[model samples]
Target: MRITALAAALVLVVASAAPASAAAADGTYEYKLLAKAKPDECFNGIGVPYPAGPPCAEGQPKVNQAYVWGLTRVGTDIWFGTGTNNNCLTTGATLGATKPVLNADYVCEYAESQMVKNDPKIPPEIGDVRPPEVWVYDSRSQRNTDLSAQIDKRSTDDKYRRDHTIGLRAAGNFKDVVLLAGPTAEGYVNVFAFDARSHRYLGSTTYTGYGNVRTFLQYDNALYLGVGVGVNGGDGGAVLRWTGSLKSPFSFDVVASLPVQAADLSAYDGRIAATSWPAEGSVNAPEKMAGVWISPLLADGLPGLTTEDAAGWKQVWNARQYEPDKVTAATYGMGGVASYGGYLWWGSMHVPMKATKVHQKVYPQDTDEAKQAQVKGTQRATSIFRGKNLGTPDQKIELVYGAVALPVYDGVTKTWSNKTTNYTPLFGKSGFDNPYNNYTWRMVVTDGKLFVGTMDWSYVVQDIVSGGSQVAAPDPVGYGGDLWMFTDPEQKATAVNTTGMGNYLNYGIRNMIVDGTGGLYLGMANPMNLRTDLTDDVPEGGWELIHLTKSCK
Candidate 1:
């Protein structure tokens, strides 16, 4: 009788070993990888073939523009993660005309379908899911359906995210040590962990309601500290917490809250630091600015930055006030902060509030000197067709994003100072006049170096005066702000990296993510996802993904 009972117990144990559905296969990739989707053979996502009809017959080849919202390196495979940011392809400058620039940022959402699932609607409810998701490219199978249905599910977070910076720390080449995803528009951040050997999701934790995570950090182990976006724009929100017990599913708790509005958090040497938001209207509405805040790597009440405190704990430095005279805030939605060159940096992104683009832009007739002779022989006239830059550049005045480097030594005292300034312009905005004043939506700089990623393109800058040479309006004198990079220590950046990413629709500058390798992931509205231009496939609506190997290097 004892032997027979033991056999029964063994059977039950074997049955309970069923794999967890949320957890991928033993070798399934998690949040770190870039993989392309399968393409449809006959119906393409482009101008005509998709929703309305195939564009091939109309002389418009169906091409896809891809934009990447974020990147997750799961296993050895690198995934350019993103979702259909908007009906981007269809949202063209003109009502009916498609936006070529935005369209190139990514293949349409419909186009991504063939690559993942064959079912009509996916698990996440196509419209409900968020972009910037992790896809496993290494496990591609001819039967695209081989992947778990999670990729197809729609998102439940806020509609779209304006901030693209995600906090990431690495353990090794294939594993993403930690990924703290904080969307600017919402109050939730998804925590994901990768097991290098197993290549799957080991654990996940979700923290809800933190206003907007302006910035966060994955300190020590599972501990994540988030700051920014006060509650309903109130005084400020608390420094919450999320705990992962290492059990199958995880839970979170609020350890402690602070009175000050912290913007971003910096972690190093087992200690954590942060900056507070200035008065509201100060940058946009200074009356509401909160100032800077700091904390230890281990928050109050929490033992340490560990898997137990996934949500976070209380304040270590408490809240510190900022004096308007000593510090200034950046424009709303135009400011950013980064940790590089051994300090935390903050800056405001500036762009001319005025529209500098003319209805008719001057285009060189041809590269051949002979073909360009029309400029030398023909007498210039002021007619509309005469070809001239009509509008004056708001060059020096392009909107300015406030900036400051944390742990930076003040020039006079040579002490670590957290100063704020209005303007991402490193190459003296006062020096030149550019007809096409490029509005810098996003930028990064440190050690007297700079990198500017604009809504149009990217650029690296050097000497402010030398860089902004005399030139006609459209090609802004300051070498046009592409992805700007300033690696020098003596001054900020004024040049650009020569490499190119798709430019047509550069909206991702307002929404982007950076990886451990300093790769900047941008999302743009793309047309390549449309099956047809007329079928309402969102001819110009999609996303684009660009990989900048290194912003500082």
Candidate 2:
């Protein structure tokens, strides 16, 4: 009766007690696949493209995984930037190598046996290799154009040409100029601009102080960028603002320096609100959890608001302040934030790595250390919170989804106070309550409805253990990217579409944009070509763009 690794994985999926839908029906909406990336072309230091043949052939260039990380719309054209995976090109690496062997997940690993044929100096690390691609899709003519070559031409240096841009992380539109956040050769996040009117690459501004700019928001006529990685000499994330014109040589000024990584930014009630990843510290490090902070509304008019003006900001919510009593250590990070339905809504980031029985052998359930691990691993439910009237001290912060109640810190009592209430679950009631679906990756408010895109890792888990078999009884909760719409404030969120536009290979919808006609544009995130085993379903294991158009009901 001893179960194998593959069989154990299958049992976990079947035990979920949920049923999978075969296909989408006619009444709701329709999905159309727009574009997909070809196999990654090996290039030299001078931008010389090498064909995928003979010596350079590594089983059809295995790392064809791509994700649309940046999306923006200008006029009738939708622009997107993609990030490709090179983890599959490693020498002797296994997926989830850091985890225990029995409970190890190889969903993120690639089985390709491709060797680095051209470059010897390129390390096997993630960011050190692979270039990102940019594309433009015209809604009028329904044409998609690959603009990677034009973006490649912007850099003439051997370092940039060899390493390639690390992919466009975030995008924003200021007037008629489109700004994209990407990495330069010097290990800094640079802002590249394109004239939407003329359709030409304007120029790029190098932010040597920051490593990666991952999020952007335009408020009041200025552009605000979120820094994920810090400068070379210093550490910690920052929120920077570009107040200069849309021309070359942009001026960037640091507004605030955060203790952890800055994840997303949004404009709420004439103020800029930011969310951050948890800081690196001990398991019970109360100050190391993620939180939401907002700047003073009047600070926008300040001519020189720098890091010295940190006192002008206020912290409304911190994840550590809301931890349950049973959970010992939780990595509470915030992902996407939006101002919708008269409230500032934000989603939690709780990724469960090792909560299965195989991991419990390393740390037993009764000990303190085991309690901490279980809290961190098993408490993967992502909670949604909203604050009404953010600027006031007595602002009502309510938990809309996932948890029944959470503990909030009381300064007067100097201890955690339980804020118990009749909390509602958005997807849990519908049987889509897996921890993998907790990543509220992105959100957009369009057509009087709030659209949410989630990163579902159930497919990755199944692919890793089951070797990508559809015949196996599927995870009851299902897998792939999930799109939900909250049209009526009184009603629960409705599932608009799922399984990444019907392509189960697409595990997440990282980027989303709304066209001029209120139609939704979804960008798929399928990295490391995890769907290689399912070649019958997806011929190329790259990312795809899916357009979801609502019919007149």
> For this target, which candidate reaches the highest lDDT against the unseen true structure?
2
Candidate 2, residues 446-510: lDDT per residue as tens digits? Answer: 78888778877666556445544444434433666777777865566767766666766677788
Off by over 4 Å in 2: 1-28, 41-58, 61-65, 86-123, 127-129, 158-164, 183-187, 229-234, 282-287, 298-311, 325-330, 352-379, 405-432, 467-477, 528-540
lDDT of 1 by residue, 1-553 (tens): 1222323322332243221111111121112213232222233443332343232433333333233433444333444334332333222211122222212223334324332244333321122122344443343341111111232332322222211212221111222332334432233444444443443445444444444444334445544444433432244544444454333323445433555455544453344544444433343444334322334346545565444443343322111112122222222222334444444343322222100011001222323332222212111100000001111142112112222222122325423344432324333331111212223333343233444444322111111112323122122222222344556433544334211233222232433344345454433323234322344322232443444443232
Give residue 155's error in model 2 in angstroms: 4.1
Q: Cα lDDT of model 2 overall?
A: 0.60
Best candidate according to TM-score? 2
Cα-based lDDT at residue 145, candidate 1 = 18
In order, candidate lDDTs are 0.32, 0.60
Kindly report the root-mean-square deviation of model 1 from the true structure over all alpha carbons: 21.1
Question: Which residue pairs show backbone clashes in model 2?
Answer: none
